[model samples]
Target: MGKYAQLVIGPAGCGKSTYCNHLYEHCQAIKRSVHVVNLDPAAEAFQYPVSLDIRDLVCLEDVMEELGLGPNGGLLYCMEYLEDNLHEWLGEELEGYGDEDYLVFDCPGQIELYNHLSVFRSFVDFLKNDGWSVCVVYCLDAHFVTDVAKFMAGALQALAAMVKLELPHVNILTKVDLMEDKNHLDEFLFPDPELLLHQLAASTGPRFRQLNRAMGGLLEEFSLVSFLPLDITDEDSIADILGQIDMAIQYGEDAEPRIRDELEDGGDDDDDDGGGDGGDDI
Candidate 1:
């Protein structure tokens, strides 16, 4: 019996915190117990309940003050510090769980951690070795993906994360609730590659025409790149996204089957008593 973890990761300001908060509420509404672990040492505040916090081990402000580092530099330093002290820091934080507990780790917003760096991957491997099933939830801002070229960039970044992680990965388009007109979103949501290439080439000022076509061809070759639209305000949309993640993690497959209780009362025999009928039959 191993615990389950959903590693919520994404670019900066891409609604990772909002998604974690929404997931916490969603699980609570469904009567499912879930714990959110804050892994961002630089995170100032969060809206959800944090079961485990990295700041308990190392705080970014303290790191910045002591090491004379800025916000970004302090974040990188904190992550490196955690890596050096993983056994004492993250190991202790993950202790005392009964294996069935669900944990959602709200990771840092730095894309490098997921792309070229192995820090997060090492953490993931650590969890897996400790008997926790892990799933990577890569979120991209939907607002930034309104245009064809931007959408392509988003897709490529997501692909890079997927390749780097090499685990069960899910791409999510976030902040959809903020869309003024969803029609533009629909085009990118279910885009046809050829049509997108034509649109990108036509929209760009001829300098990027060749580049757009080449990029579009690469996207067509790899069809696994797709996004699950996320609207934090919509419960149904959240459920749908969770459903996909649940499948990836096989969330409830090990649970006991639900049984219906049998009613022990409520039948009446008006014609005769149950015991009397046996003697009166003759």
Candidate 2:
């Protein structure tokens, strides 16, 4: 059986950590074994227990201090450094987990990494070659649903990441519990191109009308992007999002048959033992 992993990624403050924390707790509640890996070198605190952290290999603050780079530049440098040492550090660490293990990688918020960089692409390729089913989970702030323009930008970002990675992708609207108007989410969740184009035209100048139409058409035509709303306070919401990801990666598909086989074998042994006891009684 192959292992499974989900790359939890989004912009900073999009609740990646919170999602990880809740996912970890939810998995535990359901008696599921899961491990979370923190791929963010700059992350100082976490709401969930991290099984593996990038800071142990390279620290962003130290890189910024020693190499004299800004936050974004430092994060990029840290990831690049990780890429260089994947076989030495990450590969060895992953060997500890079995084929049935499910890993959740909490990645940094740097959009550049997924947008135009080869770092995460290389990392994902490495995981695939090592016999793991990987899925990309992109999170957007739920508040973006309130504005058509903001939602479009977030959708485009998700689309870019999906195209670049070429993996089983899941998009999430995080922090739904914080939204003041839940009704605003329905339109964005099940988007209509014409409606969005009209909204965009009203929000922007006439000069950008054609561009908005084109963008809206792209979203509607491909039909590749949609978001699962995530409310950390709601267990059903979390379970629904997790269920979508599991289906994307086909997690536990192989185990079901194996479990059935084991049950059948045990039943056969029980029947044989019962026949022997009945013969002895006669």
Candidate 3:
């Protein structure tokens, strides 16, 4: 049996780690056992407790020292190495867990991993083959909501990942707490198709109008893109987000129902025949 897992993915500085940390706390409050696995070989520090760490297998500093590769190159190399040894590295890391365990993987922020590369897909397949039900959590920065063109671009990138992974997914807009003027957030939250197209065309340069139109049409046609706002500071928001993901993975549905076995209506297993009944016995 394999474990249940979620891959938290997004571009750099989009608060993937922050989201993971917040999720860790949220799970704790709800009394749900969740383990976080750090998959970024170059991660410097993290706020959450890591159950399984890839740095044990490959660290960027060690790769750079031995192979003289730069940071980006080293990261790619580390991922490639993991891919080459998926069964060995990831298998060993996941040794102790039963099939019912839940894990949240804090993946690297490199967009290329999900965009055109097969590393992430391969990893997902490995987990599935091992019997895990996996979900992809793709995050975008809510700060980009103010810019129509940028939002379109980010949405398309997320869409591309959704199509490529072809798994259960949840799109999140992170850092909502940082927004000063959240009134404008509603426009981006539930976007109007035609209005979004017009705004995209106006904000972008002339060169991008055609691309923007195509993207806008795709989003409107399939209704494939929507984001749940995530404010790391708000516990309620975190709980809501976690609840959505939990539903996606179908967690806790397989447990046996609790049954009441106690006798009712003042029934007793033992009655002493009216307090010993010595006269009747004689």
Candidate 4:
């Protein structure tokens, strides 16, 4: 009875929208009805059609102008405004799409939103309350980290998000195609803590050696967060990532078995009744 949704999230320039675009195209190619809800108030452009745009409810420019707030402040204001109107404006928009429709909510890239703030948690609660089985897709750029320290930092950032949101989460390493040596990314994907520790030991200060070991050990011990490589150029890669998400949220697992139309059954009965019309024979 509930609909499925993917809450696409990441830091800025991590290709959240691009990921959504690719996913939209994939669903369309396969004849799946997946709609997008743009939750980013400051979004400039979109590659896919939007089912419900938060900008229409509260634009960032409008908030900045009306309240004399900066861009970051304005964005926060817009999200709060959206939350206030979820029952009235946003609820109506969701109802228009109706139930059983898979929706992808392209969320804002601000790290604070997912980590420190409770706003997104409230948003997720709202979706769950409204009969939506929601999954969070956290994306990170594969090329963002050039060294072990950076990789560790990115991993911890993702870990923080996973802990904060507490949803059926999937971490994505986007733009793998942009990487020079894709093999360099293997350690992060499967997350070999020993390899990372060796690299970390080489880098960082002596005072932080214990710190690095502790952090690396914590990450390896939990093993909850792992990245899935996503190269939008490759169809198989996209499908593999999407398949993981679909299984996570149990997509299409609850659908009722389809039944034939009454007319179809009646037509079959008529065929058995008699082939020729009685009037024609007469």
Candidate 5:
């Protein structure tokens, strides 16, 4: 049996940490065991109690102060440092969890890590090699739907991560509750290429519209980009998103046999209790 994990990733302010926090609360409410690993070394606060934090291994602030690097550079350095120490640090910490444990890794907001960088790819490889099933949970702000160009750009970003990670991917449109007109999401969720092209033509000049057409065609050709809306205020919405993730990684598939085993043992106990002394009573 392998442990399961979802790497929560997105641009800054896309609600990645909030999603993890809400998921932690929801799992606790339902009595489902889950652990949140803070992979963002620069993260200063969290709404949920972190089970494991990369900052404990390598803090971005410390790296910046010592290396004299800026925020983004410092963060990149910290991730690389963590990558270097994966076996000695993260591997040791992960050993504490059972095979059935489900881990949610709250990743840093740097899009470069998922799109082109090898750091995250190496980290994911380590987890998979260590007998863990992992998936990418790509988060995009729901506001991206309001603009045709922005929505296409977000989709391309998701596609980039999918291509780079090559793992089970679940794209989420976060903060849907903040959108005044939820109808705007419908077009992006189930996009009509023609409609998108028309919108692009209206928004951009002719030369740029040609570029939009090519971009839209590329997206259509791949046909792998779609998003599920996530409204944190709605428990059912959160549940539906979590269900999608669970299916992506096949999280609970192994538990069915264990459940059957328990039920069989219970049946034996029932048989012993009734068959021995109460056999004639009934």
Candidate 6:
């Protein structure tokens, strides 16, 4: 048996932390256990229970002061430092977790880490070697995907993470409730490439419209990525998103046996109490 985890990742202000927070709360509401690990060393606050914190190993402020690096540079350094110490520090941190435990690793908002960087890849490989099943949950802000160009860009970003991570990937369009016209998101959520191209032609200049056509064609040709809207405010929406993730990671299969065991044990106790305890009391 292996531990299951979702690496919650996205750009800054895309609601990665908020997604983790909501997922944590939803799990609690349903009486399911899901633990969160804050992988962002720069995180200063937490809204959910943290099982493991990267800040304990490396703090961005401390790194910046010691190395005299700027914010991004300091963050990159901290991630690399954490990567270097994965075997020693992370191994011990994960020791407390067991099979059937579901972990949500709330990652930093470094686009480089998700693509064009080996740090996160190496870390993910380490987790795999340690018998953990992992999935990548890539988030994009709903407000950012309003236009055709932005939709193409967001899709490509998701595709990039998929290509780089090489894990089970789930893309989420988050903060849907914050969108100016929530009803208008349907077109982007389940996009029509033809419609997108037409919109692109109308919106942008001629030179860029050609580029948009080329990129849009590439996206249509690949047809590998899509986004699920996440309001987070709606329980059904959260459950639907979680269902997709659970299916991708085969979580239901792992849970069935545990549920059966508990039910059987409960039945045995009920039978014992009714027959033996009742007669003894009489």
Top candidate when judged by TM-score against the true structure = 2
Winner on TM-score between 2 and 5 is: 2
What Cα-based lDDT does every candidate model obtain? 0.83, 0.91, 0.85, 0.85, 0.90, 0.88
> How close to the true structure is residue 226 of candidate 3, measured as C-alpha lDDT?
81
User: Which digits, one per residue and each the tens of the lDDT, describe model 4 over residues 1-282?
Assistant: 458999999888899999999999998998888998899999989999988888888899888999999999988888878778778887788776656788999999888888988788888888888888889999998876577787888888888988888889999999998888876777788788788888888887788988988998889888986899999989888899889998899886655333345655676678667763553454
TM-score of every model versus the real structure: 0.87, 0.93, 0.88, 0.88, 0.92, 0.89
RMSD of each: 5.7, 3.5, 6.4, 6.0, 3.5, 5.2
Residues 228-274 of candidate 5: C-alpha lDDT, one tens digit per residue: 98999999989999999889988878779989999877877887887
lDDT of 3 by residue, 206-238 (tens): 998788777778888878788899987788898
Candidate 1 Cα lDDT to native: 0.83
Could you tell me the C-alpha RMSD of candidate 1 in Å?
5.7
How does model 4 score by TM-score?
0.88
Ranking by TM-score: 2, 5, 6, 3, 4, 1
lDDT of 2 at 99: 79
List the candidates ranked by lDDT, beginning with the highest: 2, 5, 6, 4, 3, 1
Residue 273, model 2: lDDT of 78
Give candidate 5 misplaced runs (Cα > 4 Å). 261-282
Task: Give lDDT tens digits, candidate 1, residues 83-190.
Answer: 778877778777877667999999999878888777887888888888889889989899866677778888888878888877788888999989887876766765
lDDT of 2: 0.91
Name the lDDT value of residue 48 in candidate 5: 98
| Residue 58, model 5: Cα distance from true site in angstroms | 1.3
Candidate with better lDDT, 1 vs 3: 3
lDDT of 6 by residue, 1-282 (tens): 458999999898899999999999999999989999999989999999889999999999999999999999999999999889999999999999988799999999989888887899999999999998888999998887677777778888888889888999999999997877776787787677787889888888888876887878877887777889998779998899999998888886866898999987787688687775653465
Model 6 bad stretches (over 4 Å) = 255-282
Quote model 5's TM-score. Answer: 0.92
